[model samples]
Target: MVKQFVRQKARNITPTQFIVFTYLTAVMVAALLLLLPASVKEGKSISFLDALFTATSAVSVTGLTVVNTSETFSGFGALMIMGMIQFGGIGIMALGTFLWLIFGQNISLSYRRLIMVDQNRSSLSGLVYLIRSLLLLALLFEGVGAVLIGSYLLAAGYYDSVPMAFYHGLFHAISSYTNAGFDLFGDSLQSFSNDYVLQGLTMVLLVLGAIGFPVLIELREKLVKKTPNFKFSLFTKVTVTTFVTLIILGTVGIWIVESSVYYREMPWHQQLAYSLFNSISTRSGGLATMDVSEFTSPTQFMLSVLMFIGASPSSVGGGIRTTTFAVIVLTLVNYALGRSEVRVFRRTLKQEDITKSFVVFSAAVMIVILSIMLLDALERQHFSLIKIVFEVCSAFGTSGLSTGITSELSAPGKVLIILLMFMGRVGILTLLFMFRSKVTKDRYHYPKEELIIG
Candidate 1:
């Protein structure tokens, strides 16, 4: 009966609106669950604001938290948080479709439309297969990650018992793979900063989660099926190239900026590991082995830029998206060279795509700047401008890493962060579209006129 009511109501709304409503509903449900006495460590009730904030963070897969994960939340609460991470990471529509399949319900056209919007797909075709593949791939990756990390945690004596080790391992696996940034360890893997096995496994999961699901599907087709002369789509090529390039640039930038500063006394291997881990983490993983505050100003600024870039489109992570960045850069380069058209990988870019990319990028910049200004005004006496900017970027990108001011944020500051997280997850354009009036054909054209150039 409830499902029927929800479906009926959802049918009345646009897909973008439906997606926003779904996440809001999830946040409310998770908040209520976390409010239960059994969810807390000492059976003490948590404030409604805190519960809502944490729920929003989890459902948004943003890791900014007011309370410590290990000390405040009991096993049940942690599991609830983990479940929200998976829901947010994979998307509510995918999970709904998976359950519908299990219950032998027919997927309607409306359902497919919702999935298309949720996954950022251009077409409704093969959505069911896509959902199935996504669930299976997620389970396989998280399962293998759990086993590897769990066994290693047990061997390393991180936990007193196998069950505890497995629980933490599973939590970390889900969190890292989803790029949710939640951690069972109090310091967020800091104790194992030099643990190459753990960091390496985590980095792999992070990349897989943030690289976009379509890319993974394409990779499977090419690598597993051994498709003859399989070629990646333009989307795949752009996303992958931009993703790898950002990682390399971030790694080198951090190493150069921090080598003579923070990592001066550390061994070369440890320095390399820290640089690589931080570079990846800043891009949306959120797990930190060292305090971000320890880094120099230049490194922190670079991280803010990386966090702003975040991850790829149609993936767990957030930001303006890699393709948008790529398109904007290409457009600028082409314009500077006086090229007739923007081109990439031997293919001419669509003007519509280029325009949309700039729109998205411009809106993102505006939002981040406005958010930083608001945060600075609210918490100027408590924190520096850079810290406020970092926090704002982290919230907007859903990257979750902080210079330790999350807990100190005032009520208004927290609320602002919550809005930013929601906007980041739902996307700037989607949220803007919700308020935009419907469009109709103009059926007429205006005379062309020259305008002043820059």
Candidate 2:
């Protein structure tokens, strides 16, 4: 009777719900781990709420923190945080499958479905193989990043010892590759502002982490496998085109906006570097080479807009996703030209994808706006609207850029941010799927009617 009851309860849980619950459970467990006596500093203690927020941020790879990670946590706690970042940055199921493969365990259909839901993939076929390939690639990239970063730190006199330098190198390497953005230096990449080597490497890692994995996979196949007549998927094409375009626009927009402010006296190279870094970071990296608050009001808001768009689908970063933005943009352009169908790259997009893109975009905007309004209503007496707006967008994007207001948010505000981070990481579509009503056929349909025209 107990077994039957448990089975029935299990049957009631949808894949999306299970994925959501799994992330929540992981966050809670990580929070608990951070609270361990071994994890905390010798003289420090962290509150439950802060620990949870930090865990959620790390797990979501958003990098927003209410407390300073460097000063508050011991090596043990840092390790726990890094573990969360790795698993969270890599979809939980992908890492799960990796461990399973290492153990020589058989993959099951049920597990594949979970992977599909987790990675936001539609195909069950090749999902496991994709997982195996991505996991290896991630490791390879991180290892190289760690070695280069650590060696630079040692040679450039950032650290006194090899072990300590490599330790930081390893942490930053993982954080950058995962787009986790956590820093041990206590000020993010701000200290390395003049160090273009670190900045370049970090940017490369961030891009690798945030660009869609399928794009990376295809590029790898073209390069390594020497595949003949290999073609980039439409998803890849749209994603890369949109990503590059956004970064270019963001870099120029930022440089122009802050021309009379942050860049007024800066060298051209520094101007270009700072603008490009902020643009990329705002998209998903969250590790800033400049203080976000130091920027002009227009630049800050521009970054908020960038954060709203966030990263590509199936990447470490989160948002409505680059492809969604691309589809929506294409649809709007096609509509403006009186074209009925949306076509790009010599191929017509599926009507289903176009519709889903709008759904995701509309839902994301609604979530961001409502969250901002609610948060302002909650904390307006203390914080200004723009700060709240930036925080809200940052949380929802899981981008982690902030104007130094994160720690000051009230408990409810923190909880709201937590919810946004989880939603962003878990995904808008996945959340929609989780609460959707079961599919059913209607016996009859009401007459179609149009009430208004835009």
lDDT of each: 0.90, 0.92
lDDT of 2 by residue, 39-140 (tens): 989999999999999999999999999999899999999989889999899988998899899999999999899999999997889998889888988999
Task: Flag regions of model 2 displaced more than 4 Å.
Answer: 440-444
Backbone clash pairs for candidate 2 read none
> What TM-score goes with each of the models?
0.96, 0.98
Q: Which candidate is the best by TM-score?
A: 2
lDDT of 2: 0.92
Candidate 2: residue 127 lDDT (0-100): 92
Mark the regions of model 1 whose C-alpha exceeds 4 Å error after superposition.
1-12
TM-score of 1: 0.96
Error of 1 at 398 (Å): 0.6
